[model samples]
Target: MARNPAPFAPFEWMIAWRYLRARRAEGGVSVMTWISLIGITLAVFALIATLSVRSGFRSEFVSTILGANAHVTVYDVGRVGQQGQLDRAIADYEGWAQRVAEVPGVTRVAPLIKGQVLISLRDSSSGAEVYGIARDDLKSLPGIAQSDQAAGDLTRLDEGIAIGSGIARAIGAGVGDTVKLTSPNGVKTAFGTSPRVNAYEVVYVFSAGRYDIDRTRVYMPFAEAQAFFNREGVADELEVMVEEPEAVNALTIDILRAAGDRAQVWTWRDSAGGFLRALEVEDNVMFIILSILVLIAAMNIVSGLIMLVKNKGRDIGILRTIGLSEGSIMRVFFICGAFTGLIGTAMGVVLGCLFAIYIDPLFSFVNYVMGGGVWDPSIRGIYRLPAELNLSDVLSAVGLSLGLSFFVTLFPARRAARMNPVEALRYE
Candidate 1:
């Protein structure tokens, strides 16, 4: 019924393929084609690589926070004293810790007394935050209980003190070394309150992976902390771990109920030092900026195809004279642009995925070539760089590359379709 075989038919594909593969002397693809293809590949690769790294960084950051800190923390609102002044502490913290642990989804609990102290080893000194916990309760801590997190004798935690690796480095103190701790909370005597200064053996060293936490944290026995902080019988608060840290928000009501009246609850999402918010903001900014870059690269497709249309003017005139429709001419150029995009995107995806998947070994090689110090744990807040390849990000990149390539190709394509055969042949 019709002379044409329909749009983008086999004949159109054959002509498009011939146009793409023919030599430049035959008025085929120019140098611009290779340039546009390479640009698209490089841009897509950079976008995917950056996304994978951001994902890995977020994953490690959140993991460190959850491992080293409580999913939900329960404390007392404190009671008004006889003088109408408030004195705050979680009274009978052990009892409340047990009660909260009974709630479903709660995995572990520790009744702890927390205080700040100045730790010294000879002339070296550093400030440290101390947690008062029992030897048996050491295993209940999410981060410290891990084999990689703790070194030295965990058994002797009750007999002495456990200091963080950064504190040990700061004061040149090692396990089995004596370190002096001075607390401002002192015993009140008839004369005046005196600062509590005591020397204890550093029996173990631990790393929480978070720079702030590891640099200034230590653990003491519960009884010792109670006495050292001048609250002989009570603990500061109840630290709790749950089966699902993300679901901690839903379980806060049950925790408050279990902890009784005048109890307050907070989750790690709010309490994880404000750095998480900064990281999220950074992630959004990077994605927006990189997406713009991908767009710029896809624009190169317009430049390349425009040049191709000019070079193929004579061939286009001959085809139009032989009765080719304008739509067929446009479809032919459209296929050319799309094919370049497809091959380039494929190459970029493969390279980006491989880089993310084998990041560890690749990182090691980089660190070696740089002669170490590629990543600073103190500065970056993590010991290593990480990457996570997400399928959605890859899909988004592919869609963007192909979409821009096709859209920009239309202008040059329509020009070729509408060319006057007489003028095209007359010029040649």
Candidate 2:
């Protein structure tokens, strides 16, 4: 009759340690096994660290964009069809705007006019996207608006402007310096139209840490934008600053209910369109592609363990004949294979986290060597890469690495378990 194995003690560590020590000088553990263990360890660490860095880049990039742009945008649907009807649309828009402020989750609603415009500064001429924002609500935007200026006077008399650092650099405009703004006006009988020109002094310079926004964003009073475009008492869009960006979908539905057919509510994701879709696709693709490294490592574990099973067959047979059952023999091999995985995974988690934690400094050192790494004193921005580590990312990385390690040992352990003692002991 077979002896009953003690619960939780079937595969004890002391047995595993003795087996490992006895085989250290033997042919069971080959050079290939060591190489495979090292490979798996390195691959798992690299995947975890690489994915963390990528995640950091994605998150920082999104925050930079969201900082410059509002949570949601409300635009006149009719404005898409005709520029002439803008004057008549303001009354209906004003009524709806008031109600939007009263809606739950709605924090602030500000009128905005945006269009492409040409700007000429001295001899420098460049085309830029112009944003006409309400002077009173300017404090709501990031970078330019701050807690201190939330209630400050932001009155735009006529031609005051706030320009992004990139735009200012492109136009060579400084605070109190003037730049010419030009936009297409109504069509004429003989000619298409000429650009309506006006000069505005730069009132403020803002940086939102994104090249796209810092280079192209130009803020002006709504009245000034309407005048420049030859469309008085009209706004191109209504920008909404929500309490939370995640609430945009629900708030958008509620807004559409109020605006009905008059205006279209759009979230930041909608405004960015294909770009946002591409970002999401990129994240998923990168994750799956990077995970292949870990998979390759897991395969290495399997190869190493299979070799161990083959080399240990005779030893396993002798142990089974003496006292150890087939199940215990299997447990011995399982312990060996699992030990490799567990040790590698534990090492990888620590190494990967350390790499992530110091990635910013490492990038800084590289950038310093590149010579173009200097931050402009005037421009308040993060020239260095941003990395925000989340617990979820760490948990997923460690868990996946360990899980892969465990899975890799399963087949080899099963094979070791089912080995025929008679065939294994043929030489003995």
Candidate 3:
């Protein structure tokens, strides 16, 4: 007698064709198979697309933080409550700047004195955050390159200031306009203390795309800040630039130790803890909730295979009688179920990537349909929302969904394989 070929056979097409033929003979593809395919397809699409969107959102948040804040912030945390020595602060800044530059990944360092102050021009008055900066110190800040330049070297100006685009528009001020500023003295003026105030001309307006900053940031000279605020020598914060934003936490610790209590050190995350935590929580919750779509689709695979098992009971019984082993029978069902999942996931991955790639245009379309949309990058004062797609994110989503689909069908496939040959044959 001729030896039977391996139970699964050598040709994949043969096995697939057998399945197709069987499917057609049994009144064509069953409703269960159609449902299962669509379910898996939709699940895969939703999971992939949702993950891509979440990834986009997370990146947008990171970009916003980086644009609005420095990578590392250094400030006095001494018992003195604050430090106020321009010469001392500059000396310390130069020393720390050199040392920080020596550290691996250190890119650049910038000095700033940040404080809240009352700003008034003519009859219009508003509260704003005043950032006293040296032109050299803030030149590398994102979007600074786009600022309008004045006649003299920026750092050389003793009392010049830069306003955010929003602030300029709001106050109806422009270059050459003079404004008065007042800041609290850290003590009541009536207690033999006087708040500091000064007059300065608007030099340039910088738009950093952070709406809040664009609407409220005021940049002036370091000396001017001291004269206006009565704190001449000390800096409220030092902004350190880094090669990689992710290394900020480690660098903050190292910088703190180096500064030795002259100031508290902070990372972007520390400065924006509440927002970061909220974003993280939202990402996790969204990921978990969306995963249900894939899970539901996996369940459909199980149901479809169960229906196949019931319909093909006679075929399975005949094959077993002809010497096919239980393991081989199981492989057939597993292949069928896995194939369905594979096809759905592949399609979903393609569509998901397409969606991410064209997200901006799609949003624009929605905006156009709605009759109007936000265009100013400085609304709240800065640029528009940013988005990016990371390959790792896509790979992770597809890998997870495919793995889940396979695992979910394993037991069902085994159940069909383990059916007793005698019992299956006895049916009908």
Model 2, range 235-324, lDDT digits (tens) per residue? Answer: 666778788875578788887766556777778877666866786788678767767777777777788778877877887787777777
Give me the runs in candidate 2 sitting further than 4 Å from their true place: 1-3, 7-11, 19-24, 28-30, 79-89, 146-159, 184-195, 368-386
Q: Would you list the C-alpha lDDT of every candidate in the order shown?
A: 0.86, 0.70, 0.70
Ordering by TM-score: 1, 2, 3
Q: Which pairs of residues clash in candidate 1, taking residues 3 or more apart in a chain or in different chains?
A: none
The residue ranges of model 3 lying beyond 4 angstroms of the native Cα positions read: 1-13, 17-25, 78-105, 120-125, 146-159, 172-201, 370-387, 420-428
Tens-digit lDDT track of model 3 for 1-428: 97655656654335544663465556435566667777777776676667677666666667656765788877655442245533324336666666666677778777777779887899887788988777776666665534443222344345488877677777777777898877776444556766767788877766665667767888877777766665665566677878889767767767776665565777887767796688779877877887877888878888877777777777778878887777777777777778778877887777777777887787788778888556565342224433456787677767877898789778877887788778888845
Best model number under TM-score: 1
Q: In candidate 3, what residue range of length 10 has the lowest lDDT sum?
A: 145-154
Best by lDDT: 1
Model 1 misplacement above 4 A: 1-3, 80-85, 147-149, 360-374
Steric overlap count per candidate: 0, 0, 12
User: How much is 14 displaced in model 2, in angstroms?
Assistant: 2.1
The CA lDDT at 208 in model 2 is 68
What is the TM-score (0 to 1) of candidate 1? 0.91
